[model samples]
Target: MTSVKEQEATRRLMVFLQEWDSAHKVARSHILDNFIKSNDSKTEPELELEFSQGASLFLARLAAWLRMTYTYSTCLRKLLRSIGIFLSAASGHRYLIEFLEIGDVLILLEILGLNYHKEEDKRESVKLLQLIADAGRKYKELICESYGVQSLAKFLATSNSAEAQEDTQILLDSLGHSNPKYQNQVYKGLIAVLPCASPRAQQLALQTLRVMQDVVGEAPTAVVEPVLGVLRSTHLQVQHEAIQLLKVLMAHQVRPALLEGLVAFLTPSCRKELTFCSETAADTATLGLKEPKLVYTQQAAAAKIVGVLAKESAEVAEELIQMKVVHGLMVAVGNLDHVASQRYASISLEYFVHMFPFLEECVKNALGDTLFQHFMDSPETWYTKMDPLQAEELASIVIDIP
Candidate 1:
């Protein structure tokens, strides 16, 4: 079933591969010209016929050579790119199972550790890893078996290209969802990226972490500081996501740090600990209430979190009372300019006042009897995600405490 041209091409490739090391440049040129479509000067049908006759054997031989070369040499790079071209062909996915069978999955993953290679090389490795993972669950687990969780995490954190990081996130999210065996490992890896210097990297990590929350179960204590640290982000989406993750990660062991960190957001030192995440972000740490409209956003989100925590556990409520969360809430409640902050601050304040009524007189003293009455009876002001007030009109509830 073979033609003279096909057999002749295959023989040349095989011959070239034999002396490939001693005369790598010549051999590489011969192999590329004979097999790889772009490098081949042959007409399309001629090239197609030759590859059909020996794609499998050529790939197998290349992979064998690929496995034998541990370091990133020019010859190895050429071979790797050739394989990528094969994998990227129109019917490329057809070779995916064969690729896995040939031990290319682990080989490609090993290539990722060769940091000296161009990012293009690492990205190609990831692309192959992706194809392997996309093949099915067993292949996904195979990646996990090959120390994938750590490797992918390091790549995600360290990859300079945003596109590469995004691809890495997709791969991680895919792996995290199905591998029950490696779910926790994946979770730990994602958490490791949260502290990375790139906000985009941190954002991508958080997005994946959000999807993984329910599956990973109660998070470890290690998740506490970095996530709390994320709340300091000026990035609203970042803070918003951190809040969502906190809702799931809550456990008794983490509550002490969690509560203390949340209360610290209300403390007066907010700007001191404030890390600029976005143009609109304010300090969540110790900047206190008087900082700015930006600070109001952080305090509002922090207060909202406190309200949810308090509503869930009376014991948490008691602890927050001891922390004097009321002082910050009062400052938030008085901030008439940023009603978004006022709305969230008042909700948490209501929790403190309702659950521990002894704080009522102090609350009344802070807001005056009229504002206190409005806040308690208020429909629009009492709960979550309030709309911003119109520039021309203020909330009827805004009243100066006498």
Candidate 2:
């Protein structure tokens, strides 16, 4: 049924393929050069169409080629480059689906697990997998069924490159969104990458966790310690992101360790005070302590988390009160040096007052007459100057005053 023109075209295509598989590097290079040159004017869709039309032939060749161990790095790179190009095209998914149909998904995933492959090659493989997953929901589900989640997690845990880790995080986030059943695996993957030396990975992990928090549920207790450790990170951005994640976790249920960690931000001297109390026993019992230096940003974050947790349940409020968190908020609001911390403290105090009105005497006592009088002097101005949400909280307090 083949026309003469079709048979002639097929013959030339076979010739090009033969040259690509030549043992001589020069012959392979020449063929690849011509292929690239011929495709220079082609758009991705055009390239996709060209590849799709030749899918059966190219896929069969690729499978045999993948089975052979390439002695030449250049040959392997060229082959990977060719596959990468196919996956990168706008209609790459068409070829990807066809490849998946023949169980080539495992072959691609195998390349990701191969220690012998160059990181560049492995990254390209991951990209191809990412493209397939991005193609459609069914592809994502197929990936999950293929244990793609575990492979990606293993790579994310071991990969040295931040860029690779970030790309992996994005892929996992997308896949997690598509397949809720695999979300726990996704959560574990994010947690596995959290302790990586790369700040970007840590940030990405935290960001993905924040988005998936509802499905991920309360973070495993194992992660709580490490996440708390990130709070002390010298990088402000990492600290801020970590605080954001902690806030999310706190909103679900107050973790004692996390609350303790946040309280450390508010009162870094607590450990020293406890140590001194233990060391000196009766001698230091009556010692007057100086206020610890407060990092305003951390103070604000701690106060916001406390406010959120306090409003969540009466039991949490009672726990925070037992930890004397209210006194810390009082000290922060009373500190006139930092307006932001003052606003955060005011917000936390309003939550406490709303939840436990009997705490008014505690607040008034903690502020003392001097600071309390100052707060009352221009309460309206103070409320108006705060962020609208905080301002609303403060206004409510004013309205509730007898």
TM-score of each: 0.65, 0.65
Give per-residue CA lDDT, model 2, range 1-402, as digits (tens): 988977776777677566656646566556556655666445456863554446446655655565553332455655655655555566455656556666767777777787777766677667778878888778888888888887887787667777777788889899888577777877777776665555556677788888888877766776665575443333556766876787678666547877766555554333423111121111121123222322444465566668776776677778777777766665555445556666777777677766777776665654446545555564323433434443333222311122
Q: In candidate 1, what are the lDDT values of residues 1-402, reduced to their tens digit?
A: 888977787787666545554555566656655555553234333434655555656666667777777464665556766676556555455556566677777677777777777777677678767767776788789999989988888888778888878888999998988789888989999998886656667788888887887888776888776776666555666766776676655643677777777776654234336422343222333334344544455566777888887887788778777776777666555555667667777777876777776777776655555555766787346423222442112222332221
Off by over 4 Å in 1: 1-23, 26-50, 68-70, 74-81, 85-107, 250-257, 268-324, 330-360, 366-402
Q: Please give the distance, in angstroms, between residue 167's alpha carbon in candidate 1 and its true position after superposition.
A: 0.9
Which 10-residue span in candidate 1 carries the lowest summed lDDT? 390-399
